[model samples]
Target chain A: MNSQDAILPIAIPLAGAGVAMLLRGWPKAQRLWTFGILMASLAMCANLLNHVFSSGKPLVFQLGGWAAPFGISIVVDALSAIMIVMVQFVMLMGCIYALDAKDIAKRYSVFMPLFLTLTVGLTGVMLTGDTFNLFVFMELIVISAAALTAMSDDRSGTEAAFKYFYISQLATIFLLLANGLIYMSYGTLNMADLAIRIKTDALAGGPMPPMFTLAMVCFFATFMIKCAAFPFHFWQPDFHAAAPTAVSAMLSSVVVKSGVYGFIRMTTLLFEPFAPQLQQVLMLIGAIGVIYGGFSAFGTHHAKRMFAYSTLAQIGFMLMGIGWGGTLGIAAAIVFMVNHALIKSAMLMLSGYLASKAQIKSASFENIKGLGKYLPQSGVLFFIGSMALAGLPPLNGFVSKMMVFRAGIEAEQWAWLAAIGLASLLTLIYTMRAFQWVWFVPPAAGVKAKKDGDSLFAPTMLILACVVLGIWGESLVSIAMQASEWVQQPAAYIAAVNPAK
Target chain B: MDIIISFAIAVLFATGIYQLLRRNVVRSALGLVIISNAINLFLLAIGAYDGTVQSYAKAIGVRSDALPLALILTAIVISMGGFAFTFAMLYIVMRRYKTADIDAITELKN
Candidate 1:
């Protein structure tokens, strides 16, 4: 594959969004166009992953034929390639699910364009090798996501979008400020260049500049907010619950992973010198998030809100894995992220299906009560998703959770290990509570299930993915292990991006 | 000049945050705009300010660092787009709720 193939994942969706907007009058054509574009992007990403794994090198494409430090570079290493593939796959599934959703289809004209734009942003975030470029793509994500959130059928959707917009804007501003400070201190926006400078500076035993530490703090705050870790998690539950189900699925799955991606990049590449200190902070926050998110999820009565809290809990686990900060820990974190994306998104979509079958189109416990009997396929799918999420054996979540537990044990983090175990118990409780309430519980008096002819293909396909990955867990675990190794050692990454050096 | 710019940035940040904490949604939105501008100014202040030669000119003497300016411009454009959408959303929210008070618009909860 050509080095320029790095840009195809981003470029395809971007150009497709414009073409889709033009085909707005023809919804079928627009859907086909968007799907084709996503498929093409996915193909490119898979090809990139194949190329990176086979070549054993990161692919770096410097725009305008300029060298890395002077120009914008698109770098696709194992980690980026894996992230791109995971995101594109989840996006494709969510797109398929959206097709069968009538409420979403009603706003298809606007939804398709925004959805494609969102793909463009996400792909860009995954591909960009520069910090400023990351900030720009993140803004693209925020704009499209906020717009899509506003399009939700829920009455609170607009309000949720409003809250999401302002908070995200504030977060990105911190990112921008951090970028400026980084440039001012190191005289480079290129991450590879920054890493080299920081490494050399730390090696020289010079006093670390206060400004750089402040910048690091800012970067940390921005990503923490983006991932919705404990204290910064207020905006997430409201936003996720009120978003249209398909959008909610995407937000919970891929969008938030961007934050995790940023954190990984920071610890593994940009700020390796500071990793020891940062890892401690991350572990503390992760423990709190695990406990807080788990209990909150159990406390919530609304199905989507409960799932949103569950997302918080899941992210907490990933954060813990990342905080463990070794080849084992990072690999475990990556696995957890991938598995949770599939499990949570599928569960969210299944809840959406349940909501669609209700008299009132809401996923509230009362509205969706006993509605699962009407859709046995969704009931089964939800069961699989819940089991996967609760870390049952023979499922993807079990493999990832086991990896995390092993890593904690290896690190001898007993307190965090206990927290993870407690949260796992809570996960089982809330997930089972939701499942029984929706699928097995008897309907309330005078509440009848709507007999809609929605297809169960999308969520079912996603659950099948969880099952397959769980059973065939070795391949993904190996791949994640490889990605984590590459992340831990930034030498190959720096060399690839700055070949001239 | 650096001191003055830093002071201005600080003041702008304080004012923006003050507005942001207001109960009124419109004020909060405006506050976000102010904070964004403050950040932009902060970016400008961080760039090399000693150069007499313009960045576009090729000179033996020190040329001004143009990257931060470019970054600020990008930040401005992005913030503008976000603010436009935020204001529009705020308008829709205000219309639906019949009040701009954030406390009054409490449909979504734990």
Candidate 2:
């Protein structure tokens, strides 16, 4: 649990990606190499999580042997550790599931390279302790995502990529504006350093300049848009629906969490002092996201599009949960992140598989039907995913959703509670309709159902994971509580990154 | 000088947003280019450039901070890559769809 261990998560995938680029002519070799790299990385993530949990402290790694505040550091507390493990886990599953998604894998020789780079960027965002570095990582993510979105052969893929590119650039512009203001005020870009300086400056009886609040507002708005929250969420649906199925899985499941990760990290590191006031705002945004995403999703018919909107609704729930503003709220948000990442990746991959095997190569329930009889096991797994998404009882989603409800109640936000309740009902209705369309109905006139081999492994593992999270909910809850505590109180975080201090 | 530069940055930003809201993909891409330049200018302004110093003096007291210059250099390189990528896509989109308007690229719409 030290700085050296911190680099492993980023390095493995990056090196693998470089090697993958070299092996571009041989798809088989490329796939094998990337899979091995991801598995090794997953194991390393597990080891890091175990080590951190046992040590019960944060791991700090300063680059090039420099002092923390003087140099960039990678800090992994419980929260970061869990997110790392979760991100790596989903990515590993995605790699396996994507073997059959040949349209994307075979088309772009740089696909795996870009995929590894995306993972590196995500890990960087989660683990880095510098604001400017966060900007750099955000750029990496945007560039890779835009390229991947455009990699698909469909004409609309280019358009979707462009749309996402411009919108995300707007968000990045706001982020840079905030970072410039912060550097101007504090003369430091290290997050922990800023936290300490801001606090000490406040304690010396100098109220923060109004400019600081404006900078934080910039960070807030940018991260909210990145989260694809209610008002600025229009960019995600097209990108998610149009990307190749494997990329769609990654975009819907793991990529969007970078925004949530940034919001949580920035809040814990920079805005804990303003949590009480900010909590209400967070709840309000979360609630709006829930209802709007829910009702809108209810009207969507295409399978991937439906899932994309559902993801919107799910993020809304996550925001409301975290906005409740305490150990429970933060823990619930963390749980929601983990659960959504698992279920959505599986669901997207499954839909991709079904649609690819069908005659029409589309995910509209209109194009393919009776998927249940052709792939009964997949149908059951899909049902599990839908049920979990809708927060059906005795499932993983239920546990997190219930925690969110309890957290909302504790915060005494009856309106948030009511909105969330209605959102949940909307989710159930749409999800069930989706389930009926895919699994229960007779085959579409021209549809043909063929099950593919080894494609089921990833979804099965992910669905099993959902079950484990439910049956073993206590462990997740306890870990989430500990993680939330570590996040809420940033003293250890600051100290770990700047141990010499 | 600072006031002038700030005013110009504001104008650049205004123009960028206007272009970004255009219906044509090519124009929107042009908007992105303008906005990126404005962003670089804002970063430079935040560094509080000291114009009195001679540009070639290596050991001057009034020189501006070098960090924003480095940052702008990096930002320029990165944005060039991004813009190049977007423009290539724009070309492909134009050739494939025979139009530059995003509204007409509706094959994926529900």
Candidate 3:
């Protein structure tokens, strides 16, 4: 497909969002429109993937038919295609789970459009090949996500939305500043053109300019903040745990992954000049985040808060894997990301059900008890998701975690690898403790477990997806591995970025 | 001129960080405004350097950099929207939680 076709997937949903808002009073219209947008996005992603692997070339779409270094362009390569598929798949699951909820149905008119807009922004971020365009896409995604978080309008949701929005704005400014530094240095905003220009002008001749390094550092810093890396993770706990569970799932699973996506794209395509040291720094941060987040999760009493911290720990593992900087490492990161998206979303859904059904506002271990007897289906699904999250053998998380650990060992980054392994143990302990308290122990004195079984189906479907994916993870891993191979070999991607050459 | 923009950004970032660490909402929101403006200025400064005109009479084959200008405009709009959001949030927090102090608004406390 041409660039015209490439831009349509994102544009269609974005346009549909506006249209849905106009039709806010019609529930069926909202569902049809939003689902149509998502379906179109999925089709576009699949088509993009087909073009990427089979052709082994980058697909470049110059907006308004303008050439690069003048007009902004969007580029989709293997890595972008992979991310598009992963994000779309997760959103599809989220939409399905959401559609089934009665409360969600009530809010469908407003929620669908906002969610679609977020999807458009995320897809745009993955595909755009321009520095300034990346910031534009980031702003779009962040704004929509904040709007969605606040859609529920509860105090907690509003609070979480506020925090997420503020911190995200800070990160966006960092991103904008970095883009500015690069443009100042290179006089070009297209990423592919910037890469070539920077390489030829800056890297080839005299000592690499201090400004280049400064820009690199700023870019890395912004991405770290966006990914909620350790030391800049202050916003995540409250934001992730307090938002409605579906939003929590999307935020934890896919939204933050965009940061990792940017890092992977930048490191592979442009920052390869300093790959070794950059990888080392990323790995160090990831290792520290893993250990820190795991312990914090272990210490937390609130269930959602505990899992929120656990997400940081899991993201640490993904970043660490990516830091290894090879086909296997990047593939490992992708696989782990897909698995986390599945399991984490499922777990949060279960948590939401518990909150709605049992009036358990705190999500403390003591607040939930005898769930196995009261809501056996949700209990079992949650247990499976929890076990998967903790990297239990034969479960999905274990498969991907093992791949990442193996990549670490292959890269001979043994210390961080060991840290990850140790973090897994902490993860196991905290996870089991949660399971024991929520599902096994008797209810605390007075609170009664809701006996109605109507609400368990959404979480059950989510868990079923996790199980199926776990059982057939190899197929997805194979596709991911191929995509990673394309990313690692950047000549094709570089060509796509500067197709005029 | 570059140095001035850089210095301004540094100050904005530092102030934003400091206010972000504080326990008040309005102050942090104001700090965010400063930071957002600083970033927008930084982007615009980068796009417009010494000896350049903002507009182009398009000689079709001739290349010029106007994309950054467009981006800056977009950034301006986005930051303005964010500013409005922060102000509205401040209003709601003051009314509902009875304070704009983040520390005092811990209704969702763990």
Candidate 4:
């Protein structure tokens, strides 16, 4: 891709963000501005997706016409295009949901700009040829997340945001440190350049330095925190439950995926240096996260908190595919990642509607009873979303879940496959319980207002999206497969790194 | 030069651990800022501080290491934004609940 094309998708949102930030006081006008920005993003992403689908190779653009390795470059391969597409879809839905909110104008004004900036950062991370630029974008996303999380004036919101900010900042530092070490060793932060140097020099004589292992370990830890894996997930429930619904969707969908994206990019591009061990470590962590998150979700009563725990479990399934280390497994992982992003964002939005009707933002199971009778549409929407999350057959979730399980079997990891099944069952238990209590059980008479304003407007769209995605998942899977092909063949990425070749 | 890096890491680690263990939200946030700085220093050191100019010196028959500098500069700005966020959080907590201790404010349920 030429610099003009590569720069537009990133620049359009960034310029929008600049304008939105400047126009903060006019909350009423902010929605129009955000709508415009999201539409532009959607268009650009669609154009990029079309271009890639027609053209078999990845699009490479060196900024300012500078050559790779010496100067910064951006490459939009299949994975980049797919991720951009997913971000654009969820973000568009998020803006629509926010626009329906009445008192949230000021919040929307602040959030829209940050949201745009975060998009630029995430897309930039995925497309950038340089590893160090990945760090820059990652920081942008992290900082924006911190600000977004704390934007809520509530007690739990601020507290959760602070915890998330602290741990994530620590994770960023570790990432930066790892990037520095890799640069010191290779003298270039371009991933393809590093791969080539590692291939040529290490293949000839020298033992692969311990630096490779340490750097991978540091990188692993950083992403593990970002993904909210089993041990480092203390902040997940708090942040997910405390933040506003739209923000929660962003956290679950785009922000968390940033970490998974990093792990996939690193393992695919840099794993050759320490190939075998990295895969093994990833598999071990993935398997553990699967079991741990599922079982933990089983015990949670709060609606959104349970969903947060479930998010960790789903991430586990995606990571398992990457760890299994083959074209098929990686493809399965990519499909699952995209599927989760769609469904989970929708689930958060629906949860918001349920909370608003109850006149309490709390998502406790007991508080959710008989909402189905009062608001039939949101109740049904939540049920469908819950089913998709449980990996029920024919839904998008089931297909991706099946792919991950198949990948495990293909790799001959029978025990992990069993764990995956057990996790699926656990998912069913929690999601069914949440659905039953929220939709079926009768609420205590006169506890609160049973009906409310059109708060369900935003959440309903998310539910509609979830249903459509569940029914028509094959189209998404096909795109994921195309992305997997590019990931499997690193030539496009390599060309971006070493254009002379 | 090495001492500077070590001191920064030590201070950051100490402050981070202290704040992490505290009940006060503001203190914890301050500790996070300190730790983020330490991490940036460590990254700068690992990227190789040539004890001269920070750049790769591309103009003087030598190229400045733009990659590390760009990343660190970005990191610095991000931390500053985070710092501002922490202050905002503190203000919210103070205004709403009149408490800076995270444990004291428990209105929102999990």
Best by DockQ: 1
- The estimated TM-scores of all candidates read 0.98, 0.95, 0.92, 0.91
Best candidate per TM-score, number?
1
Give all candidates' CA lDDT scores.
0.89, 0.83, 0.78, 0.76
Q: How well is each residue in A1-501 modelled by candidate 4, as lDDT tens digits?
A: 454686677888899999988888987677689789889988998888888778877777777777887777777778888888888778888777767643242355578898788788877877787877777788788777767776663446776776677677778777877786777677777778887887786678777666766776888888889888777888888888777777788888878888788778877776565666777877888888889998888898787788898899988888899899787788898888888888898888777767766765556667766666677777677777788888886677888888888888889998888877877788888888888787677766765544444366555666666667677877877777777877877767797558686
The positional error of residue A77 in candidate 2, measured at the CA in angstroms, is: 1.1
lDDT, candidate 2, A209-311, per-residue tens: 6678888888888888778988889888888888888788888988889888877776677866776666677777778888888888889867888888888
Worst lDDT run of 10 residues, candidate 3 chain A, spans A100-109
TM-score for chain A in each prediction: 0.98, 0.96, 0.94, 0.95
DockQ of each: 0.87, 0.62, 0.56, 0.50
lDDT of 1 by residue, A217-259 (tens): 9999999988888899999999998998889999999999998
Error of 4 at B98 (Å): 6.2
As for candidate 1, its clashing pairs are none
Local accuracy of candidate 3 as per-residue lDDT tens digits, A47-153:
88888778767788878878876777877777788788878877876776666554432464678887888888888888888878788889888888887777552
Question: Clash totals for all models, in order?
Answer: 0, 1, 0, 10
- lDDT for position A184 in model 4: 69
On TM-score, the stronger of 1 and 2 is: 1
Model 2, stretches more than 4 Å misplaced? A203-207, A450-454, B51-64
Error of 4 at A10 (Å): 1.7
Considering just the first chain, candidate 1 attains a TM-score of: 0.98
